[model samples]
Target: MLSALLHVTLPLALCVLLTRCRLFDAVAVDLSYDHYAEQRVEHLPAFLAMPCNCLVNLLYIITGVYWLLRGTDNAEPEQGRYLRQVFAFMSIFYAPVQWTRLAVLQRAPAVLDQWVTLPIFAWVLVWIGFIERGAAGWRVWHAAVLELLSVLSYGLALLHERGFEVALGCHVLLAVYKGVRVQLTHGDARTLRNFMFAVLSCCGFVVLKLLDLPLARYRIFQRFTGHFWSKVCDVTQIHFSICFLTNMTSRTKKTR
Candidate 1:
Protein backbone atom coordinates (compact mmCIF):
# COMPACT_ATOMS: atom_id res chain seq x y z
CA MET A 1 0.00 0.00 0.00
CA LEU A 2 2.87 2.31 0.89
CA SER A 3 -0.15 3.83 2.59
CA ALA A 4 -1.38 4.45 -1.00
CA LEU A 5 -0.47 8.14 -0.62
CA LEU A 6 3.00 8.11 -2.13
CA HIS A 7 3.64 4.84 -3.94
CA VAL A 8 0.12 4.41 -5.27
CA THR A 9 -0.56 8.05 -6.12
CA LEU A 10 2.70 8.48 -8.00
CA PRO A 11 1.91 5.95 -10.71
CA LEU A 12 -1.75 6.93 -10.86
CA ALA A 13 -0.88 10.63 -11.18
CA LEU A 14 1.63 9.81 -13.88
CA CYS A 15 -1.12 7.96 -15.69
CA VAL A 16 -3.46 10.96 -15.47
CA LEU A 17 -0.79 13.34 -16.63
CA LEU A 18 0.35 11.11 -19.47
CA THR A 19 -3.16 10.45 -20.70
CA ARG A 20 -3.97 14.16 -20.47
CA CYS A 21 -1.07 14.94 -22.76
CA ARG A 22 -2.89 13.18 -25.61
CA LEU A 23 -0.65 10.12 -25.33
CA PHE A 24 -3.81 8.10 -24.72
CA ASP A 25 -5.81 10.04 -27.31
CA ALA A 26 -6.02 7.00 -29.55
CA VAL A 27 -7.13 4.62 -26.80
CA ALA A 28 -10.35 2.91 -27.79
CA VAL A 29 -13.10 3.53 -25.26
CA ASP A 30 -16.87 3.70 -25.52
CA LEU A 31 -17.76 7.29 -24.75
CA SER A 32 -21.44 6.72 -25.53
CA TYR A 33 -24.31 5.74 -23.28
CA ASP A 34 -25.59 3.43 -25.98
CA HIS A 35 -22.50 1.35 -25.35
CA TYR A 36 -24.43 -0.20 -22.50
CA ALA A 37 -27.66 -2.17 -22.68
CA GLU A 38 -29.40 -0.39 -19.79
CA GLN A 39 -31.93 2.24 -20.67
CA ARG A 40 -31.06 5.68 -19.33
CA VAL A 41 -33.48 7.95 -17.49
CA GLU A 42 -32.82 11.37 -18.94
CA HIS A 43 -34.72 13.06 -16.12
CA LEU A 44 -32.47 11.58 -13.44
CA PRO A 45 -29.11 12.97 -12.50
CA ALA A 46 -26.25 12.04 -14.81
CA PHE A 47 -24.66 9.67 -12.30
CA LEU A 48 -27.94 7.85 -11.84
CA ALA A 49 -29.03 7.91 -15.46
CA MET A 50 -28.31 4.21 -15.83
CA PRO A 51 -29.66 2.83 -12.60
CA CYS A 52 -28.01 -0.58 -12.64
CA ASN A 53 -24.56 0.56 -13.72
CA CYS A 54 -24.49 3.45 -11.30
CA LEU A 55 -25.77 1.50 -8.32
CA VAL A 56 -23.58 -1.52 -8.87
CA ASN A 57 -20.52 0.53 -8.02
CA LEU A 58 -21.75 0.61 -4.45
CA LEU A 59 -20.86 -3.07 -4.17
CA TYR A 60 -17.22 -2.19 -4.73
CA ILE A 61 -17.21 0.43 -2.02
CA ILE A 62 -18.99 -1.91 0.34
CA THR A 63 -16.61 -4.74 -0.33
CA GLY A 64 -13.63 -2.41 0.05
CA VAL A 65 -14.82 -1.09 3.38
CA TYR A 66 -15.54 -4.55 4.66
CA TRP A 67 -12.00 -5.71 3.93
CA LEU A 68 -10.45 -2.48 5.17
CA LEU A 69 -12.18 -2.98 8.50
CA ARG A 70 -11.48 -6.71 8.62
CA GLY A 71 -9.63 -7.64 11.78
CA THR A 72 -6.08 -8.94 11.67
CA ASP A 73 -4.04 -10.96 14.14
CA ASN A 74 -1.56 -8.95 16.17
CA ALA A 75 1.11 -11.38 15.00
CA GLU A 76 0.57 -10.39 11.38
CA PRO A 77 3.44 -8.53 9.78
CA GLU A 78 3.09 -5.10 8.20
CA GLN A 79 3.50 -6.65 4.76
CA GLY A 80 0.26 -8.62 5.01
CA ARG A 81 -1.65 -5.61 6.24
CA TYR A 82 -0.17 -3.54 3.45
CA LEU A 83 -1.31 -6.03 0.81
CA ARG A 84 -4.85 -6.15 2.16
CA GLN A 85 -5.21 -2.39 2.61
CA VAL A 86 -3.85 -1.55 -0.84
CA PHE A 87 -6.34 -3.89 -2.46
CA ALA A 88 -9.23 -2.54 -0.39
CA PHE A 89 -8.38 1.03 -1.37
CA MET A 90 -8.11 -0.06 -4.99
CA SER A 91 -11.68 -1.35 -4.94
CA ILE A 92 -12.93 1.82 -3.27
CA PHE A 93 -11.17 4.07 -5.75
CA TYR A 94 -11.94 2.02 -8.85
CA ALA A 95 -15.72 2.15 -8.49
CA PRO A 96 -15.68 5.92 -8.74
CA VAL A 97 -13.62 5.73 -11.92
CA GLN A 98 -16.21 3.46 -13.51
CA TRP A 99 -19.08 5.55 -12.19
CA THR A 100 -17.52 8.69 -13.61
CA ARG A 101 -17.09 6.92 -16.92
CA LEU A 102 -20.76 6.03 -17.07
CA ALA A 103 -21.92 9.40 -15.78
CA VAL A 104 -19.98 11.64 -18.15
CA LEU A 105 -19.26 9.26 -21.03
CA GLN A 106 -16.09 11.30 -21.46
CA ARG A 107 -12.76 10.04 -22.73
CA ALA A 108 -10.80 10.91 -19.59
CA PRO A 109 -12.92 8.80 -17.30
CA ALA A 110 -13.28 6.13 -19.94
CA VAL A 111 -9.53 6.05 -20.47
CA LEU A 112 -9.07 5.99 -16.72
CA ASP A 113 -11.55 3.14 -16.35
CA GLN A 114 -9.42 1.08 -18.69
CA TRP A 115 -5.97 2.25 -17.62
CA VAL A 116 -6.34 1.75 -13.87
CA THR A 117 -7.59 -1.80 -14.36
CA LEU A 118 -4.23 -3.15 -15.48
CA PRO A 119 -2.53 -2.52 -12.15
CA ILE A 120 -5.35 -4.01 -10.13
CA PHE A 121 -4.71 -7.33 -11.81
CA ALA A 122 -0.97 -6.80 -11.57
CA TRP A 123 -1.31 -6.35 -7.81
CA VAL A 124 -2.41 -9.98 -7.56
CA LEU A 125 0.99 -11.03 -8.81
CA VAL A 126 2.63 -8.68 -6.34
CA TRP A 127 0.64 -10.21 -3.52
CA ILE A 128 1.45 -13.72 -4.67
CA GLY A 129 5.13 -12.87 -4.56
CA PHE A 130 4.76 -11.78 -0.98
CA ILE A 131 2.88 -14.94 -0.04
CA GLU A 132 5.52 -17.18 -1.56
CA ARG A 133 8.76 -15.39 -0.73
CA GLY A 134 7.83 -13.28 2.32
CA ALA A 135 8.24 -9.49 2.77
CA ALA A 136 11.80 -9.42 1.59
CA GLY A 137 10.58 -11.05 -1.59
CA TRP A 138 8.73 -7.87 -2.54
CA ARG A 139 10.55 -4.65 -1.76
CA VAL A 140 9.12 -1.15 -2.03
CA TRP A 141 10.97 -0.42 -5.24
CA HIS A 142 9.90 -3.74 -6.67
CA ALA A 143 6.24 -2.89 -6.17
CA ALA A 144 6.76 0.70 -7.30
CA VAL A 145 8.43 -0.47 -10.50
CA LEU A 146 5.74 -3.06 -11.12
CA GLU A 147 2.94 -0.59 -10.55
CA LEU A 148 4.66 2.04 -12.67
CA LEU A 149 5.08 -0.44 -15.49
CA SER A 150 1.51 -1.61 -15.04
CA VAL A 151 0.26 1.98 -15.39
CA LEU A 152 2.66 2.82 -18.18
CA SER A 153 1.70 -0.36 -20.00
CA TYR A 154 -1.46 1.47 -21.06
CA GLY A 155 0.68 3.06 -23.75
CA LEU A 156 -0.05 -0.08 -25.69
CA ALA A 157 -3.56 1.29 -26.18
CA LEU A 158 -2.07 3.87 -28.47
CA LEU A 159 -0.66 1.11 -30.67
CA HIS A 160 -4.00 -0.42 -31.61
CA GLU A 161 -7.69 -0.29 -30.89
CA ARG A 162 -7.41 -3.51 -28.90
CA GLY A 163 -4.12 -2.75 -27.19
CA PHE A 164 -5.72 -2.27 -23.80
CA GLU A 165 -7.39 -5.63 -24.09
CA VAL A 166 -4.07 -7.20 -24.96
CA ALA A 167 -2.41 -5.67 -21.94
CA LEU A 168 -5.33 -6.77 -19.77
CA GLY A 169 -5.12 -10.29 -21.13
CA CYS A 170 -1.45 -10.53 -20.24
CA HIS A 171 -2.06 -9.22 -16.73
CA VAL A 172 -4.88 -11.71 -16.20
CA LEU A 173 -2.76 -14.58 -17.43
CA LEU A 174 0.19 -13.72 -15.23
CA ALA A 175 -2.00 -13.34 -12.20
CA VAL A 176 -3.60 -16.69 -12.90
CA TYR A 177 -0.24 -18.29 -13.37
CA LYS A 178 1.12 -16.93 -10.13
CA GLY A 179 -2.09 -17.72 -8.27
CA VAL A 180 -2.06 -21.33 -9.37
CA ARG A 181 1.59 -21.71 -8.54
CA VAL A 182 1.27 -20.30 -5.05
CA GLN A 183 -1.91 -22.20 -4.30
CA LEU A 184 -0.33 -25.48 -5.28
CA THR A 185 2.76 -24.88 -3.21
CA HIS A 186 1.44 -23.01 -0.20
CA GLY A 187 -2.35 -23.19 0.02
CA ASP A 188 -4.63 -25.61 1.79
CA ALA A 189 -8.02 -26.74 0.48
CA ARG A 190 -9.70 -23.52 1.62
CA THR A 191 -7.28 -21.13 -0.04
CA LEU A 192 -7.26 -23.30 -3.14
CA ARG A 193 -11.05 -23.07 -3.34
CA ASN A 194 -10.88 -19.31 -2.81
CA PHE A 195 -8.32 -19.01 -5.58
CA MET A 196 -10.49 -20.97 -7.96
CA PHE A 197 -13.47 -18.77 -7.24
CA ALA A 198 -11.36 -15.67 -7.70
CA VAL A 199 -10.11 -16.93 -11.03
CA LEU A 200 -13.59 -17.89 -12.16
CA SER A 201 -14.99 -14.55 -11.10
CA CYS A 202 -12.21 -12.82 -13.00
CA CYS A 203 -13.00 -14.85 -16.11
CA GLY A 204 -16.66 -13.97 -15.81
CA PHE A 205 -15.77 -10.32 -15.41
CA VAL A 206 -13.76 -10.33 -18.64
CA VAL A 207 -16.00 -12.50 -20.80
CA LEU A 208 -19.26 -10.96 -19.65
CA LYS A 209 -18.04 -7.44 -20.31
CA LEU A 210 -16.80 -8.50 -23.72
CA LEU A 211 -20.18 -9.96 -24.53
CA ASP A 212 -22.12 -6.97 -23.25
CA LEU A 213 -23.61 -6.06 -26.62
CA PRO A 214 -24.00 -9.58 -27.90
CA LEU A 215 -25.65 -10.78 -24.72
CA ALA A 216 -28.22 -8.01 -24.79
CA ARG A 217 -30.35 -10.06 -27.16
CA TYR A 218 -31.12 -12.39 -24.28
CA ARG A 219 -34.00 -11.32 -22.08
CA ILE A 220 -32.23 -11.44 -18.72
CA PHE A 221 -29.31 -9.53 -20.16
CA GLN A 222 -31.49 -6.72 -21.48
CA ARG A 223 -32.16 -5.13 -18.10
CA PHE A 224 -29.17 -6.53 -16.22
CA THR A 225 -26.73 -6.60 -19.12
CA GLY A 226 -23.44 -8.50 -19.34
CA HIS A 227 -21.65 -5.29 -18.47
CA PHE A 228 -23.59 -4.93 -15.26
CA TRP A 229 -23.05 -8.55 -14.29
CA SER A 230 -19.38 -8.13 -15.06
CA LYS A 231 -19.17 -5.52 -12.35
CA VAL A 232 -20.80 -7.97 -10.00
CA CYS A 233 -18.17 -10.54 -10.89
CA ASP A 234 -15.42 -7.95 -10.49
CA VAL A 235 -16.57 -7.19 -6.98
CA THR A 236 -16.87 -10.88 -6.21
CA GLN A 237 -13.38 -11.37 -7.56
CA ILE A 238 -12.08 -8.73 -5.20
CA HIS A 239 -13.78 -10.31 -2.23
CA PHE A 240 -12.41 -13.76 -2.90
CA SER A 241 -9.00 -12.25 -3.56
CA ILE A 242 -9.13 -10.73 -0.10
CA CYS A 243 -10.17 -14.03 1.39
CA PHE A 244 -7.48 -15.99 -0.44
CA LEU A 245 -4.65 -13.54 0.20
CA THR A 246 -5.55 -12.97 3.82
CA ASN A 247 -5.81 -16.66 4.47
CA MET A 248 -2.43 -17.20 2.91
CA THR A 249 -1.01 -14.39 5.00
CA SER A 250 -2.43 -15.94 8.13
CA ARG A 251 -0.88 -19.24 7.17
CA THR A 252 2.43 -17.48 6.71
CA LYS A 253 2.16 -15.86 10.11
CA LYS A 254 1.53 -19.15 11.83
CA THR A 255 4.42 -20.82 10.07
CA ARG A 256 6.74 -18.08 11.25
Candidate 2:
Protein backbone atom coordinates (compact mmCIF):
# COMPACT_ATOMS: atom_id res chain seq x y z
CA MET A 1 0.00 0.00 0.00
CA LEU A 2 2.81 2.40 0.87
CA SER A 3 4.52 1.52 -2.34
CA ALA A 4 1.37 1.99 -4.35
CA LEU A 5 0.76 5.38 -2.77
CA LEU A 6 4.26 6.47 -3.56
CA HIS A 7 4.18 5.06 -7.08
CA VAL A 8 0.74 6.15 -8.16
CA THR A 9 -1.00 8.74 -6.02
CA LEU A 10 1.99 10.97 -5.38
CA PRO A 11 2.66 11.45 -9.08
CA LEU A 12 -0.98 12.27 -9.67
CA ALA A 13 -0.88 14.92 -6.96
CA LEU A 14 2.27 16.48 -8.37
CA CYS A 15 0.69 16.60 -11.84
CA VAL A 16 -2.25 18.55 -10.51
CA LEU A 17 -0.11 21.06 -8.59
CA LEU A 18 2.32 21.75 -11.43
CA THR A 19 -0.44 22.29 -13.95
CA ARG A 20 -2.73 24.28 -11.74
CA CYS A 21 -0.41 26.69 -9.97
CA ARG A 22 0.46 30.18 -11.14
CA LEU A 23 3.78 30.31 -9.31
CA PHE A 24 6.15 29.05 -11.99
CA ASP A 25 4.35 31.12 -14.62
CA ALA A 26 5.10 34.32 -12.80
CA VAL A 27 8.66 33.24 -12.10
CA ALA A 28 9.36 32.40 -15.76
CA VAL A 29 8.17 35.77 -16.92
CA ASP A 30 10.12 37.63 -14.26
CA LEU A 31 13.29 35.67 -14.90
CA SER A 32 13.11 35.90 -18.71
CA TYR A 33 12.62 39.64 -18.66
CA ASP A 34 15.26 40.11 -16.01
CA HIS A 35 17.71 38.17 -18.16
CA TYR A 36 16.84 40.01 -21.35
CA ALA A 37 17.07 43.38 -19.69
CA GLU A 38 20.35 42.56 -18.02
CA GLN A 39 21.86 41.36 -21.29
CA ARG A 40 20.73 44.50 -23.07
CA VAL A 41 22.07 46.93 -20.48
CA GLU A 42 25.06 45.32 -18.82
CA HIS A 43 26.16 42.90 -21.56
CA LEU A 44 26.26 40.34 -18.79
CA PRO A 45 25.34 36.80 -19.76
CA ALA A 46 25.22 35.84 -16.09
CA PHE A 47 21.57 36.78 -15.95
CA LEU A 48 20.84 34.58 -18.92
CA ALA A 49 22.66 31.76 -17.19
CA MET A 50 20.36 31.91 -14.17
CA PRO A 51 17.41 30.17 -15.76
CA CYS A 52 19.49 27.17 -16.72
CA ASN A 53 20.63 27.00 -13.13
CA CYS A 54 17.03 26.95 -12.06
CA LEU A 55 16.31 24.09 -14.40
CA VAL A 56 19.26 22.17 -13.07
CA ASN A 57 18.11 22.83 -9.52
CA LEU A 58 14.73 21.37 -10.33
CA LEU A 59 16.38 18.23 -11.65
CA TYR A 60 18.52 17.92 -8.54
CA ILE A 61 15.52 17.98 -6.21
CA ILE A 62 13.94 15.14 -8.13
CA THR A 63 17.12 13.12 -8.09
CA GLY A 64 17.94 13.88 -4.47
CA VAL A 65 14.59 12.60 -3.28
CA TYR A 66 15.37 9.35 -5.02
CA TRP A 67 18.71 9.09 -3.27
CA LEU A 68 17.13 9.68 0.11
CA LEU A 69 14.32 7.17 -0.30
CA ARG A 70 16.09 4.49 -2.32
CA GLY A 71 17.82 3.20 0.86
CA THR A 72 21.31 2.30 -0.53
CA ASP A 73 21.19 -1.45 0.03
CA ASN A 74 20.25 -2.55 -3.47
CA ALA A 75 23.53 -1.30 -4.87
CA GLU A 76 26.70 -3.37 -4.73
CA PRO A 77 28.60 -2.83 -1.47
CA GLU A 78 31.19 -0.71 -3.17
CA GLN A 79 28.61 1.37 -5.05
CA GLY A 80 26.42 1.74 -1.99
CA ARG A 81 29.24 2.89 0.23
CA TYR A 82 30.42 5.27 -2.45
CA LEU A 83 26.96 6.75 -2.85
CA ARG A 84 26.57 7.35 0.88
CA GLN A 85 29.96 8.95 1.18
CA VAL A 86 29.34 11.13 -1.85
CA PHE A 87 25.91 12.19 -0.68
CA ALA A 88 27.31 13.12 2.73
CA PHE A 89 30.00 15.18 1.07
CA MET A 90 27.46 16.88 -1.15
CA SER A 91 25.13 17.67 1.72
CA ILE A 92 28.09 19.40 3.32
CA PHE A 93 29.16 21.18 0.12
CA TYR A 94 25.63 22.35 -0.55
CA ALA A 95 25.60 24.51 2.59
CA PRO A 96 28.37 26.75 1.32
CA VAL A 97 27.10 26.96 -2.23
CA GLN A 98 23.63 27.78 -1.03
CA TRP A 99 24.97 30.48 1.24
CA THR A 100 27.11 32.01 -1.49
CA ARG A 101 24.32 31.99 -4.02
CA LEU A 102 22.00 33.68 -1.60
CA ALA A 103 24.49 36.14 -0.15
CA VAL A 104 26.31 37.10 -3.33
CA LEU A 105 24.05 36.19 -6.23
CA GLN A 106 21.02 37.62 -4.37
CA ARG A 107 18.89 34.83 -5.81
CA ALA A 108 17.43 31.96 -3.95
CA PRO A 109 19.07 28.82 -5.25
CA ALA A 110 16.72 26.12 -6.45
CA VAL A 111 16.33 22.62 -5.09
CA LEU A 112 18.15 21.32 -8.13
CA ASP A 113 21.29 23.08 -6.92
CA GLN A 114 22.28 19.71 -5.57
CA TRP A 115 22.45 18.40 -9.12
CA VAL A 116 25.11 20.93 -10.06
CA THR A 117 27.46 20.07 -7.21
CA LEU A 118 26.27 16.89 -5.58
CA PRO A 119 26.49 14.33 -8.35
CA ILE A 120 29.99 15.23 -9.49
CA PHE A 121 31.12 15.31 -5.91
CA ALA A 122 29.53 11.91 -5.52
CA TRP A 123 31.36 10.48 -8.52
CA VAL A 124 34.75 11.77 -7.47
CA LEU A 125 34.24 10.70 -3.89
CA VAL A 126 33.01 7.32 -5.01
CA TRP A 127 36.10 6.82 -7.13
CA ILE A 128 38.28 7.82 -4.23
CA GLY A 129 36.38 5.54 -1.87
CA PHE A 130 36.73 2.71 -4.33
CA ILE A 131 40.49 3.19 -4.25
CA GLU A 132 40.55 3.52 -0.48
CA ARG A 133 38.47 0.42 0.04
CA GLY A 134 40.84 -1.61 -2.17
CA ALA A 135 37.84 -2.76 -4.18
CA ALA A 136 39.33 -1.41 -7.41
CA GLY A 137 42.81 -0.58 -8.59
CA TRP A 138 43.47 3.13 -8.45
CA ARG A 139 44.78 4.77 -11.58
CA VAL A 140 46.32 8.14 -11.00
CA TRP A 141 46.23 8.71 -14.76
CA HIS A 142 42.47 8.26 -14.91
CA ALA A 143 41.93 10.60 -11.98
CA ALA A 144 44.17 13.14 -13.63
CA VAL A 145 42.17 12.93 -16.82
CA LEU A 146 38.87 13.52 -15.04
CA GLU A 147 40.33 16.32 -12.96
CA LEU A 148 41.76 18.02 -16.04
CA LEU A 149 38.45 17.87 -17.85
CA SER A 150 36.66 19.19 -14.80
CA VAL A 151 39.10 22.10 -14.48
CA LEU A 152 38.83 22.92 -18.16
CA SER A 153 35.07 22.95 -17.92
CA TYR A 154 35.12 25.19 -14.86
CA GLY A 155 37.62 27.55 -16.44
CA LEU A 156 35.51 27.82 -19.56
CA ALA A 157 32.47 28.73 -17.51
CA LEU A 158 34.43 31.51 -15.81
CA LEU A 159 36.10 32.92 -18.94
CA HIS A 160 33.57 33.30 -21.72
CA GLU A 161 29.92 33.92 -22.56
CA ARG A 162 29.83 30.30 -23.76
CA GLY A 163 30.65 29.15 -20.27
CA PHE A 164 27.04 28.11 -19.78
CA GLU A 165 27.39 25.73 -22.68
CA VAL A 166 30.54 24.27 -21.18
CA ALA A 167 28.83 23.81 -17.84
CA LEU A 168 25.80 22.24 -19.51
CA GLY A 169 28.07 19.90 -21.42
CA CYS A 170 29.73 18.80 -18.21
CA HIS A 171 26.30 18.19 -16.71
CA VAL A 172 25.32 16.11 -19.71
CA LEU A 173 28.43 14.01 -19.25
CA LEU A 174 27.72 13.60 -15.57
CA ALA A 175 24.19 12.45 -16.26
CA VAL A 176 25.45 9.97 -18.82
CA TYR A 177 28.07 8.65 -16.42
CA LYS A 178 25.50 8.16 -13.68
CA GLY A 179 23.14 6.39 -16.06
CA VAL A 180 25.84 4.08 -17.35
CA ARG A 181 27.19 3.35 -13.88
CA VAL A 182 23.75 2.59 -12.48
CA GLN A 183 22.96 0.27 -15.35
CA LEU A 184 26.25 -1.61 -15.28
CA THR A 185 26.21 -2.00 -11.53
CA HIS A 186 22.58 -2.77 -10.82
CA GLY A 187 20.68 -3.46 -14.03
CA ASP A 188 17.51 -2.57 -12.22
CA ALA A 189 14.33 -1.65 -14.05
CA ARG A 190 13.72 1.22 -11.65
CA THR A 191 17.13 2.67 -12.35
CA LEU A 192 16.42 2.56 -16.08
CA ARG A 193 13.10 4.31 -15.50
CA ASN A 194 14.81 7.01 -13.45
CA PHE A 195 17.38 7.60 -16.17
CA MET A 196 14.68 7.78 -18.79
CA PHE A 197 12.72 10.31 -16.79
CA ALA A 198 15.80 12.47 -16.17
CA VAL A 199 16.71 12.46 -19.86
CA LEU A 200 13.14 13.14 -20.90
CA SER A 201 12.72 15.97 -18.41
CA CYS A 202 15.85 17.72 -19.63
CA CYS A 203 14.88 17.15 -23.26
CA GLY A 204 11.36 18.35 -22.67
CA PHE A 205 12.57 21.66 -21.28
CA VAL A 206 14.87 22.17 -24.25
CA VAL A 207 12.02 21.40 -26.63
CA LEU A 208 9.69 23.85 -24.95
CA LYS A 209 12.28 26.58 -25.09
CA LEU A 210 13.10 25.88 -28.74
CA LEU A 211 9.49 25.82 -29.79
CA ASP A 212 9.08 29.25 -28.16
CA LEU A 213 5.86 28.18 -26.65
CA PRO A 214 4.35 31.20 -24.95
CA LEU A 215 4.30 29.64 -21.52
CA ALA A 216 3.44 32.98 -20.05
CA ARG A 217 0.20 33.03 -22.00
CA TYR A 218 -0.75 29.37 -21.88
CA ARG A 219 -0.88 29.16 -18.15
CA ILE A 220 -2.50 25.75 -17.91
CA PHE A 221 -0.23 23.79 -20.22
CA GLN A 222 2.74 25.64 -18.89
CA ARG A 223 2.04 24.79 -15.30
CA PHE A 224 1.01 21.21 -16.01
CA THR A 225 3.97 20.31 -18.19
CA GLY A 226 6.40 22.16 -15.99
CA HIS A 227 5.25 20.51 -12.80
CA PHE A 228 4.55 17.13 -14.35
CA TRP A 229 8.02 16.73 -15.85
CA SER A 230 9.62 18.09 -12.68
CA LYS A 231 7.74 15.61 -10.52
CA VAL A 232 8.25 12.74 -12.92
CA CYS A 233 11.99 13.15 -12.58
CA ASP A 234 11.59 13.38 -8.83
CA VAL A 235 9.43 10.29 -8.43
CA THR A 236 11.47 8.23 -10.82
CA GLN A 237 14.64 8.89 -8.86
CA ILE A 238 13.06 8.08 -5.51
CA HIS A 239 11.55 4.86 -6.84
CA PHE A 240 14.84 3.71 -8.33
CA SER A 241 16.89 4.49 -5.22
CA ILE A 242 14.53 2.76 -2.83
CA CYS A 243 14.31 -0.29 -5.01
CA PHE A 244 18.07 -0.35 -5.30
CA LEU A 245 18.59 -0.11 -1.54
CA THR A 246 16.00 -2.77 -0.80
CA ASN A 247 17.69 -5.16 -3.21
CA MET A 248 21.09 -4.53 -1.66
CA THR A 249 19.84 -5.08 1.88
CA SER A 250 18.20 -8.32 0.91
CA ARG A 251 21.34 -9.53 -0.85
CA THR A 252 23.53 -8.68 2.13
CA LYS A 253 21.28 -10.54 4.55
CA LYS A 254 21.30 -13.58 2.35
CA THR A 255 25.11 -13.53 2.13
CA ARG A 256 25.43 -13.22 5.87
Task: TM-score each candidate.
Answer: 0.94, 0.46
RMSD of 1: 1.6
lDDT of candidates 1 onward, in order: 0.86, 0.41
Task: Mark the regions of model 2 whose C-alpha exceeds 4 Å error after superposition.
Answer: 1-33, 36-79, 88-134, 138-152, 177-190, 205-213, 221-256
Model 2 C-alpha lDDT versus the unseen true structure? 0.41
What lDDT tens digits, residue by residue, belong to model 2 across residues 1-256? 2332243234333433443444323221112333211112234354323333323344444444445454444435544444443443333334344333422343223322322342343243334333233334444455446544543443443355455455655655665565566456544566466555546655654454433334424556433434334434433443343344334333433444
Positional deviation of residue 226's Cα in model 1 after best superposition, in angstroms: 1.1
Tens-place lDDT per residue, model 1, 117-220, is 99999888888888887876668777778877887788888898889989999999998888888888878999999999998999899899889989999899
Q: What lDDT is reached at residue 256 by model 2? A: 41
